[model samples]
Target: MNLRRLKYFVKVVDIGSMTQAADVLHIAQPALSQQLATLEGEVRQQLLVRTKRGVTPTEAGKVLYGHAQLILRQCDQARVDMDAAGRGLSGAVAVGLAPGTAAAGLALPLLRTVRARHPGVLLYLNETYGSTLSELVMNGRMDLAVLYGGRVAVHGLQFLPLLKEQLFVVGPASLPAPPEHVPLRLLGEMDLYLARPYNVVRKMVDEAFAGIGLAPRVVAEIESASTLTAVIADGLGATILPESMARTVVGACKAWQCRIIEPVIEAPLALCQSDHLPLTEPAQAIKEILLELVAALPGSLIAGDDTRLSVS
Candidate 1:
């Protein structure tokens, strides 16, 4: 079928509602429905199962969805290949890093590596929350994302487990030096400022607290790294972070970091990209360099308990 119709179908499935997809596509709902009917006539099979909540792919739709994703990705790649015919590997590759995570440290190194390897290529680096980066990658706006939460099962995206980062509790410099290893309950007893629940580290912290049948005394849900750093500097509260990010935060705010002990928690770091989208030659080169840099991260920050991390 035509690429336009396939795109419409994919958008509808991604959004899970005909009306919503039509709005997003800037088309009338009747026109979108007719397109779907035409697609069904061509395939001779009903593709979607509609319900009050939304629409889900039927068994036949499931099979087509997989193939459609591949086909769409292949077409996109073909365009890139044509554009780069005389240019040698060159194009824009957007990469997203989760702010306040160890991935933030990767920005400079990634920039340097890509520049040295492919001077002709353009690299766009963005730092934001992990969930937002993942969304951009799924929508094909970003080529790659280095983010926490590899252990999450996100639709339309693939995660390549890179490494695990040890969790640490950080506080202002004026506070007393904590025990060599701090207990989770000790932090629970104090006021804390932390990332929003969508953050993988936040999710881990919440789950750890839940294991003890209690919740953390989070006074604020701070999403921006600058905001978190400013609050920590003022001694508003202490929060948990991965080893590298914790060190980065503490360095900025004159704070101290100590590993948590009661139940050691680690967040999985991963290279995220669209499952069906093949990387361009330039992007592939950059991705390889990124992996090399990640593999060279300091041993102290890497989690010792696991050989690899995965969603349970």
Candidate 2:
């Protein structure tokens, strides 16, 4: 298949409108449609369907879209690698750090370390949910990520266990303070604001609460950092978070934090990357520095024994 047609198809799928995609691709709409049609013919599948809402991919198109992204990414990386073959390591390395996880702490240091070591290399720091990071890494859009969970191995990716982060109960200063190390059962009585059940830390919090046969009285579910900070600053409710994130949250919102005792809840932190897509020189250097920083993290909670897992 032609790389140009695959690029056109991806652009169309991304924008979901033939006209909009044409505009973004800086081509005529009819010409863009023809290219897409040629791509569909080459693949022998109805890749897209016109919808009242715009263009939607067919089942086949969805599968193609995934592979198309990976292919385009690899092609771009190859060009970059070849161009810089003898010019010293230089290329963009996208590193995703799931916000509110232990890895969020690495952003500034990673940038600083990379800047000091490989001035030619560029770093892209993305702070988002782990699921989004995992999807990006799997699709080859991201070079690497630092996130929690992934105890079971995921195909095409690798998880290098870095640390076991403990959980904390954090709240604004206006609210009555809890003990230095509060029991897990006490959380059942507290008004809480937490992420949805899908979050890795949320799953750990849920399991811990379930073990005590009580549900937390969550006043609201907050996923955004800005919104969560506002809610806590207003003393709307307390929240349960991993130790690293709890410190960040408390520091930002002038909140108080305490460890969760009785049954100490902990989440695994891991360095994730594509097992098959070997990193470039610069990316490998960044990975090594990242591991060193995580190792020297204050109050180190290095993960036990389990060194490998899949993204799932």
Candidate 3:
């Protein structure tokens, strides 16, 4: 099948209308429709169902769409590689950032660095929960990720240790100030609001409590950082998170408060990528930039008296 025809068919399925796809592809509607017909003919299967409402892919079309997407991405990458053969670093690199401090602080600076240093490079960033980011990186959807604790062997991905971030007990300003440093037992005793078990930070928190034979009094399981902060700020309950997250949350509404955890439960941040697929040149450059940036983060964001971990 022709790559151009496959691309046209994929575009049509994506937009669900030949006319709209034609407008985006800058090809005439009839020509686009003809390419789809040719693609279906080559496959000897009906790919799309046309209707007045719009177009929907048939089962065969759906399968073809998945393969077509990968093919087109590879084609684009090939073009980029060829264009950058003897020139400066130029290509697309996708990096994933875990939803808390990494997303809150790192993205803007990383984007600026990419723009200033490698103007030819295109960076796509995904900011989400660590679990999602892990899956994306392992499945070849994301090139790299900055996330919290996880096994180095999971999904055959490489997890290079970055730095540990201290967890803090955050509450509303209306509540009486707890000690500057709160104990794990005290944290467990309080009505705590935390992320669900799927979150990497939540897993770390759970494991830390379980390690000391304590069952935390979690009053709510929330997935959204904003919602958790809002609830804690409204005096609903207290939550535990990194200092950077606390700063971001309280920056918006000054009613939130935080205290460093005594004996300090620290979450190890790691840079992860699939070892099966080697990093491209541009990806490697961006990775180095991220590592440098993480190393230079202020002491407030870095756990006090904590040493950075290095792992190849």
The number of the candidate with the highest TM-score is 2
TM-score of 2: 0.87
Error of 2 at 17 (Å): 3.9
Clashes (backbone N, CA, C under 3 Å), per candidate, total: 0, 4, 0
Clashing pairs in 2: 153-310, 154-310, 154-311, 163-303
Query: lDDT tens digits, residues 96-136, model 3?
Result: 98887644588999999999999999999988878888878
Q: What is the Å distance of residue 233 in model 1 from its true position?
A: 1.4
The CA lDDT at 122 in model 3 is 92
How close to the true structure is residue 128 of candidate 1, measured as C-alpha lDDT? 81
List candidate 1 segments past 4 Å from native.
1-77, 299-312
Residue-wise lDDT of candidate 1 within 1-312, one digit each (tens)?
878888888889999999999999999999998998899889999999899999999999988886787678767767877888887677778899888777888899888877887887889999888889998888777888988876757777888777788899889877776896988877768788888887788999999999978799989898877888888899887888898878888889789899997899988888888876667787787777777788788642234333232332
Stronger candidate by lDDT (2 vs 3): 2
lDDT of 2 at 182: 97
- The stretch of ten residues in a row with the least summed lDDT in candidate 2 is 301-310
Model 3 poorest 10 in a row by lDDT: 300-309
**TM, every model:** 0.73, 0.87, 0.75
Residues 204-281, candidate 2: write the lDDT tens digits.
888888998988888888899888888889888899888877888888877999999989988888888988877777
After superposing candidate 2, which stretches have Cα over 4 Å from the reference? Answer: 19-34, 50-55, 299-312
